[model samples]
Target chain A: MPLDLPNPTDLAVPGFIVLMLAEMIYGRMSGRAVYEGKDTLTSLLMGTGSVVAGLIPAGLGYGAAYYIWSEWRLFDLGHAWWVFVVAFVLDDLAYYWVHRFGHRMRWMWAAHVIHHSSQHYNLSTALRQTWTGKLTPGFIFALPLAFLGFEPAIIAFVSGINLIYQFWIHTEAIDRMPRWFEAVMNTPSHHRVHHATNPDYLDANYAGVFIIWDKMFGTFIPEDKANNPCRYGLVHDLGTFNPLRVAVHEWVGIVRDMWHAKGLKNKLMFLIGPPGWTPDGSRMTSDMIKEDWKRRQAVKEAAPANIAAE
Target chain B: MSLLQLLGSVIAVFIVAAIARWLFPVRFRLEDAHLHRELERVYPDLEPEEILIDRAGNAALLRLSGARGIVVVRRLGDKAVLRHWMPGTKVTATRTPTGLMLDTDDFTEPKIVLDLDAEGVSRTESWLALLAAPDGHAHAA
Candidate 1:
């Protein structure tokens, strides 16, 4: 029997409206304002950017899938329901990589930085997304799922579900879940670690619905209540709530650094190098500062009288 | 398109639009009424040109164009007096591949100054680099 095609757009509207309304009510109840002036605009811009980023590649994915499936009449995958499940799993698997790369890569980080720039993590934070991400990484992996006898609708629906499920995990209101559930799923606790800028928690957990990927990939670090309390946000915090700044601050910083760097090496390092890599032979890493202090101490000991006179 | 197909297409388009709107909004209205009121109080003589609220830095830069001189105030808390536009002095900074270079020839010979504070101070040769290129133009190779 043919699988009944559910409208992907229909599912998204109700889900988005419900989420927004829920965020507002919860925000009020929790004594957290839903939208801060200027922040609301920033959030909205970031949200729109993410959708635009997702849509370009997603649109192409749908077009190519439709072309191949229609040509071959490969719609009848015998086990349509199981195929949907497999598609969903594959989508989640792809998302895990996309999510991880967004954290690890410098260019990808620029787009993703907007999402984490907000110190306050709430439902609205989930909406803060990047518009230019698609141009950078490009969603090419989804093509394989389309090639493997899955309809575009199924793929789109599964992708939407994966995104929708991750929203509730953005809040601090929900603490630890049951032991068993936390063991297998990417709960809020795990996600808090992911969002934290703490030294130990950086680049730790990268999972969508399942924690298995992080566990399997050796990226999984459990919530250590004593050692690491999740301190939300990036290292060089963007202090303003302005959305446009939140979205393009890194880009501006990149251009600024690139312009000021003296050589090609410094220019490339500023744009494509790891975050906080400066041309002054100085690094922002914790270890670098410790070494600098040690060097100063050694100098002071070597010339105690000179140091005291100064 | 069949009935199901038509429904699916409409649904897909709508969902994409909603997500787009949810993610990238153009205008940002004030979320807190109190904050808005406070901003108004801080800048009672706020001219439209002086109200520089840029979203890119998450900080607003305001320049009060007064008779005496321009007063620059950063939204986060830094207030400084900008030097009046001198005939020979350059006000704009240009970026380059290398470190910043100043336009003035006086920058050819730069001096390093180290101010003493709670933290012990140390002066390096590089401190003169900024002064050497005081024109604010970045000279990139």
Candidate 2:
């Protein structure tokens, strides 16, 4: 079942390094404070771990997907031009759900937190990947693509393309694309909003290749730099550069929460609930934060009007 | 790869990470415009570029271009309080393999480990003439 196509992602490694160096040089010349020594090192280390840890699960996942395709595939969609297009589009759609749910559920977030651990958003931050994705059930989202009879190889290749496209959008170097392109594509601007911890920007813009998915799903929030400047990283920052801590902090947090939870239901919620959710109303989720912000904004807006009425 | 092989690779990665962390010796940099504003109360003329902050902006070390002393600032309340390290101040500084620790008669608590590599500590000692002399020298500030 070895799909004879070369690993596109492996070939892109040299390109990633060259682009990072170029970005670093540009950052230095521009004095943008793009890269910090410890932070960059930590990100690269995480990326290295991700690539290594990914090896075992990647093979396992491919095998599972291949098995499903061989046994249960409905249509024999041959390798035609339109088939590539269909594969690319469907793979991206699967990515959206996986990415979306990865943020929404605390269980998936335990693995996804590694990517958001870095405070600074840069090219290296793009390399900051999850080492524990194998533990999450998000890969099951792709099973539908295989069952629908798209080749696993095509799905993998298209996924690689999506990833390579996403790498460049992790930088602050590029601002916005052309109006039409920005509207349609997931450019750096839109992706910045996705990474932002700002209450207005949280849980918004979850698109891989196409911005239209977010637009259609009501998750799109345009990058508003002036009013709500994007603050990168977790709401509560991981203050240490310990690679092990960065990698496993969220997972440890989830375990700790579950241990302290009072009942079976509470423990289940701890695992499956959105982040920042607590049994008591002490902590705030993204929804709560957003609602609170809206209330405050309304109050501020009405203050002047009330004064005028007076 | 088999499960054992995968586990071995994971272990190897951790080992590599540990070695890299040891070799690099992590140091956190703290500099922001808000920090500059806080420090401005003490040194009105202090330039943000000349100041290097550490310990999550709780402590800062500054080298003024024309000034003769090393200025140390500690964040208190909402403001950063500055103290000048004069030529005659008794500053006891120690350097271990891990980091640099500086203690002075001027302050009650020791300046926490200025987490730096061996080379960075030496460079800082050279920059501050007070720490370079035999009287002020212990390891390096």
Candidate 3:
């Protein structure tokens, strides 16, 4: 079969439907609401957009890798099996960095924020992905796998497995496990922390299947139900279920802020600053913008009546 | 497969094993003995009236009904946080004379089973049930 041809994993239609059904069942069982009309439709649309965008480049990358690896047999590496293993790990390791960067960089966050836009964390939230994400800087990670002499099919399969493992962790149904399991692997608790908008938990855990990367890099934060409740969604919610708005909301916000910026430094800050970071004279972080707005309103109301009465 | 291929296959198998261990993982459950011991330590005052283990053995749902009310502690991993609470109202009150009937509808809705024992019973079961009704209160409408 031609490497570029669609495979079972590529046609994730069945998996997507199954995921929706599972989310509904699990959500109801856990006393959480299932898809509420428009949100369900919006999530489906946004997820479809993300998948379409992601597949195009991914398909091209796979075809190129397959051609090169099958033709050049670049390394004198003796075992086909060993080559596959190394390629898979290397891809995952690269994925860890890519996933980390997606959170750290504003440009990447525009695409990634779709996944976190849901206020209620459920399986549908997992499907609320961004089609524009593949256009980000780190999609280049596939090149390294290509250079490493692994067939694109193998690379794609390994990447698919990594993604599949992430699905079940999207639930609140499963809690903690054995100490050793949690200490090493990324459990539901760890992922819950990752999805939380709490300052203490924001961007703390960024592992895929193995949390060793987060632990090693010092990004891991254990779930503390007492001190840190997992509040789902971003600090400033989009407040709408429109997929177009969800996909480009941050990008639009970035452009507007950049345009209003008074200086080159502020303009750059608008682009590169953390998701909520802003350059207004008030020096308010994006996460605190709503609070600042309320505080300003309160101050306005508290001003001396005579001064305004004139 | 030649000697070189054999060596390569062995190496490949180990690498795949490591990746599998990293992803699509299997985890160890918190043993019932350990969970009982921890619950005892956390809530030394109340005795565990009943312990319900899920079929998968991944989580243990403990119900501690005392004079205070009902305390549901879900034990997952090393943590046994307060999962649900109902206070002041007798557990028997919610249960019919035959015992609390298992309503599949209850499982269908998203209800916050409060830890009433800790803070006192602030809301009634009927109130909570209404709040959790699937007519869609949780979603931002």
Q: For this target, which candidate reaches the highest TM-score against the unseen true structure?
A: 2
Local distance difference test, per candidate?
A: 0.57, 0.74, 0.59
- For residue A243, model 1's alpha carbon misses the true position, in angstroms, by 2.7
Superposed Cα deviation of residue A137, candidate 3 (Å): 0.6
Q: Could you arrange the candidates by lDDT from highest to lowest? A: 2, 3, 1
Which ranges in model 1 have alpha carbons more than 4 Å from their true place? A1-10, A13-37, A52-79, A225-227, A255-273, A277-310, B1-141
Per lDDT, the best of the predicted structures is 2
> What tens-digit string does per-residue lDDT give for candidate 3 at A149-229?
666766776777777677678777676889999988788889999998665576777888888898888888899987657
Instruction: Give per-residue CA lDDT, model 3, range B7-118, as digits (tens).
Output: 5434443343243233323344545686667555334456665555433444444545442333343322223333333332223224333222222111111122222331
Model 2 C-alpha lDDT per residue in residues A1-310, reported as the tens digit of each score: 5466655666676677778777777776785536665677788778777877767657667778999999999999878889889888888889989999999999999899889877678888988898999888887999999999988888888888888989999988888899999999999899999998777888988899999999999999999877877878776556456678888888887888899999999899988999888999677788987897788779989999999999
TM-score of predicted chain A against the true chain A, for each candidate: 0.74, 0.95, 0.78
lDDT of 1 at A79: 44
DockQ of 3: 0.01
Model 2: residue B46 alpha-carbon error in angstroms: 29
Output the worst ten-in-a-row residue range by lDDT, candidate 2 chain B: B20-29
Give the docking tier of candidate 3: incorrect
Candidate 1 lDDT tens digits, A234-284: 655554555566777777767777888898988887766666667675545
Interface CA RMSD of each prediction in angstroms: 12.7, 10.7, 17.5
Return the lDDT, model 2, position A242: 68
Runs in model 3 lying further than 4 Å from the true structure: A1-8, A11-13, A30-35, A55-79, A263-265, A280-310, B1-141
